[model samples]
Target: MHRHKILVVDDEHLIRWSLEQNLKKQGYDVLVCGSGEDALRLVQDEAPDLILLDIQLPGMNGIDVLERVRDVDAEIIVIMVTALGVLETAVRAMRLGAYDYINKPFNLDELAIVIKKALESHDLKREVDQLRSTQPKKFSIDSIVCASDSLSRVLDMVRKIAGSDAGTVLIQGESGTGKELIAKAIHYESARCDRPFVAINCAAVPETLLESELMGHEKGAFTDARTQKKGLFEIADGGTVFLDEIGDMPLSIQAKLLRVLEDRVFRRVGGTRDISVDVRIVSATNKDLLAAIDEKSFRGDLYYRLQVIPLLLPPLRERRDDILPLAKQFIADFNREFGKSVHEISARAEMRLLNYDWPGNVRELRNVVERAIILESDEVLQLEHLPREMLSVAGTSPASQGLNLVLPADGIDIEDVERELIQQALDATHGNQSQAARKLNLGVDAFRYRMKKFKLL
Candidate 1:
């Protein structure tokens, strides 16, 4: 938002000199040019926030410069400077998007006022643009970061699904497994990238209003229907409409939805006309739609129609190889967000991250990293930064959590169970003793003694 550099363009030496001195006094980085050609070059090089342009210049007058400046960057604030009695030319300058104009009688106070207001307005605009630019990085198949083969296969499926003209897509996953992110990746990777991508959660809306929400209503359809409206399908025509939590959509709406899917046309809530749309319906649900169908809550016909291209997102715990990589990616994001220099994850913290079964999936991991980055002020992320719940769960066995075991009529040896567990850990880690010890939550010496006792060396 800080208005840094400015370029002053005029044919007169005194006009340029006076304006340069004034702007410099105001703590602005000032660049001055007398001719239109030099002014253009300075604009291209300096990329100034504001330009003080005179209407009469050597080659290609101020209006010409203003027009070309717009071509290069339309956001630059321009204020025209003209001689007295040139109202017609000044009017022409305004038409070319000049912010304001100052006449011959150099009123420093008035010029200062114009520049201050213009830059303030421009600063507001730039701040809004900056906010829009920093929104969550758009999801595309190429932008997804992962290190696990399980997820790699899922992403590979997504890549093929996106390239094809598969109109109906059903993303199935556990809650917080980023079903919507996968849906966006498919839409953005496809030819519909330039069109709108709208989303609505079927569970969040009431069953009474869900139909009206998805398939607009004509006026007088209901008491609240004050006017005709365009539904998500119509609004997202030639694009995509992401129906999150489609399993919760009521059966009545499901019947209507099946018609839309089959025929590519739908009737408004109270209208007879069939409004046709060409939107890709991307639905996602964490629930077992097949089970819902068995329960008769979800329509089987709709389920089959919707699952034309079924995409399954693997849970985060199943993709443990990606844990550390995703954690680091979140760390980098939070470092920029919180202005911290946290770069390393302590060994113990890494072990904790790799051990926990994140029922909440990637969303939980992102939140944990964000919390750690906000609270940890050091260069490394450590165990102390973790939530209390995570601390209690890390490296803890199920038996330690009060899980009871029933012994058979003939009791078995506990040492044999321990030995078998140790062997499995070693095999899982491919004989890396240190990692095997970590997996068993034992010290290297303790594991070595067990190895010697069991003759596992």
Candidate 2:
């Protein structure tokens, strides 16, 4: 119930006094200024919520004073006051961004109405500005680099779902496929952007401890439970809870999680009463929940509940076009972080990077660029700056024969040769499936399926 502060500026003392009295009667805190200089100083120091400015000031004219005040804080509402028949001046003031204009010898009732309207508009504008400030910049969306049709479709779906209040969204993808980034984008774009976005990794925590970590525990709930604690669901009451690696969530806890999702109610581990909370759930996992359900590892009911909005993120190899763009972005970010002047990549390095399969996806590329920036002293990242494995893959030529086998002298089906090379790469990489896939320029899922098809696993 804080009163709005209003400033009254006029060379005429009588007019200033009358306006102050009227504004005070309307429950506004009024500050009176006799000259434009005093008004400008007041605006700089006090920053009143609204100003009633007279155009006929002694030293600085009202328009000039308004311009200066705008420089100080453009959002502050300014209402221009002038003598009657100064319609042209009022229009000019409006053009210069005055909130409204008032005429001298005006009706007190009309002036009060104008002030009230102006105050309301100013308050609304301030609220909108505050909300805008809370939102992440549009440029942050560019951070999600993707060019594959599947990935693009997933992004569109995420945008549409962000506008709704859907209870749960489950993102399914291979490891290093940017699932968490998509979760962040959804939360940042949704209505809950102003609230907290809490994330917990189910696989990273032990089965014995995850329940307490999620639902919290009452004092003396267990050996180390000395103090009562609020759970992640309660903490994210009005926002989102990102459950990463959800496929690995323990089955015992899954039942409680299902209850929370279905009933919007949960209880502390040893507490008696149920606590209802309003929280959006966005879960992600590299493992296939269907397979886990078939194996009696994951719950089918929870899977169905969590998949209200299912988004699948494509791996890096499937979206090759984004590789270079993502690399360049990481380079720029590393440049700023490391305070280096390296601005370009050598031709060989660029070719190697584009040709090599990035098993780690964007996260791996960022790590590679950060390593190069840290190790390289030159202005350009050269081929030598790359890891040895990447360099070896880049140097592999068709004519080279290995210890395992030799190619036919005449020729072989290029596609057959490519498949053989992929298998050899997989073998050489010691069944490090992701690394082998990268070496052979194959997508992770495709490589995995091929390995199983060929009994190479």
Candidate 3:
């Protein structure tokens, strides 16, 4: 690893010498300059990671040097050195993008603390930039594995529409059906793939804060808005902003969102300036927006704008052909994750997977596969290795595949049967109550109530 370089620019010889010695001892490649002109030259020639600049210089002052340094390389970390009473100039330097400032006659320990912070921030920025550069490949279309024609057609549609100029897209799907994944595919396939892809869930954030989260807020706009914030739309300018669970958005915010869709201009909260952003809007929801509009909870105009390129993701049961393929993918993923050698799914296991009603969709399938992979030690996933509920289905006769319900000659206990089924689901999920509840198509509270009554908790 290369050592970080630090440049100390000061007209005073003692201060520059002291800083250079201390920084050199700390394994930094230290460079020194007497005047602002010499400092600018060193900034170009040395290209130091950080510059400890003195506010009082002979020819060109430190403020001028800081501005010019930014002009040369905006990313270079600069810390202003100021006298105790020269705070006003230091504040101005901060506005010019100084990382932080230190008082002259500064404690060496305090200076060290500030320097450590600035360097860490510089490292984080580089890592983020690297991740941003590789995001397209990470979210590429090939990342989504499916064997069904319904998904294939949807992928084809994604490609066709990705090249369009700023078309609004609305993706509708059942919960856990990979709606966000589809949104990412559309974004990564588009012309603005290199830019940011900001996502926010309308349902996740509180209603009171959702508008500010989308449109940004000026400093002191509200009680807790102490600092200016750039919202999702502003941050995702020239790219895509994915509004997830858009059906749950408040109607008041819907009107604001509609204004943005109609005219790409929105004023920040408590601000007069209309900020314009060229963001592609891609909204997703599991709820029926038409139903919402009929119920007076959603805006019809916004719905029309959002549905310009509507993409519907079919539920897992409808696309039974993809279940085994998705299972195999999950097995491969878990093998790497858990360091296991499980390879193939048995024919019986596949049949059970195909027949079961996936109420929670793909996400549920992934969890089930992960659970089996973690529990089973065998090389192949057999019927016995599968979940108990799945094994129950697999064991039933071919005639009973469609409907396995048969009234016993001696009337069976219905409560006992319900408890047994719930127990099997809980066992299948390794005591994960939520997954079990989803598998049974019961609400979490209802499932908990049953578990409590059965003493399964």
Candidate with maximal lDDT: 3
Clashes of each: 0, 0, 0
Off by over 4 Å in 1: 9-13, 24-27, 33-46, 53-137, 223-227, 393-457
For residue 323, give model 2's deviation from the true position in Å: 0.3
Model 1, span 1-457: residue lDDT tens: 4647889998889888888999899888999998888988998888999999988998889989999998899888898889999999899888888888889867987888888889888888878887654432457666677888988998998888888888899999998888988889888888887789999999999999889888999999999999998788898999999999999999899999999999999988898999999989999999999899999999999999999888888898777788888889899999999999999986556666776778899999999999999887889998668886775533345655342223322344677556656765775577899988997789999999999999988
lDDT of each: 0.85, 0.82, 0.87
> Which window of ten consecutive residues has the lowest lDDT sum in model 2?
401-410
TM-score list, all predictions = 0.72, 0.62, 0.60
Clashing pairs in 2: none
Would you list the rank order by TM-score, best first? 1, 2, 3
Q: lDDT per residue, candidate 3, 1-457, as tens digits? A: 7689999999988988998999988888999989999999999898999999999999999999999999989889999999899889989999999999988789998998899889988899898988976777778788898788999999888888786875699999999898999899889989999788999999999988998999999999999999999888999999999999999999989999999999999988878899999999999999999999999999999999999989999998878778878888999999999999888875445555766777889999998888888998988886566656554423343454555343332345677567767766776678899988987889999999999998978
Per-residue lDDT of candidate 2, residues 275-341 (tens digit): 9999989999999889999999999999999998888887776676677677788888888898987
Q: What does candidate 2 score on TM?
A: 0.62
- Between 2 and 3, whose TM-score is larger? 2
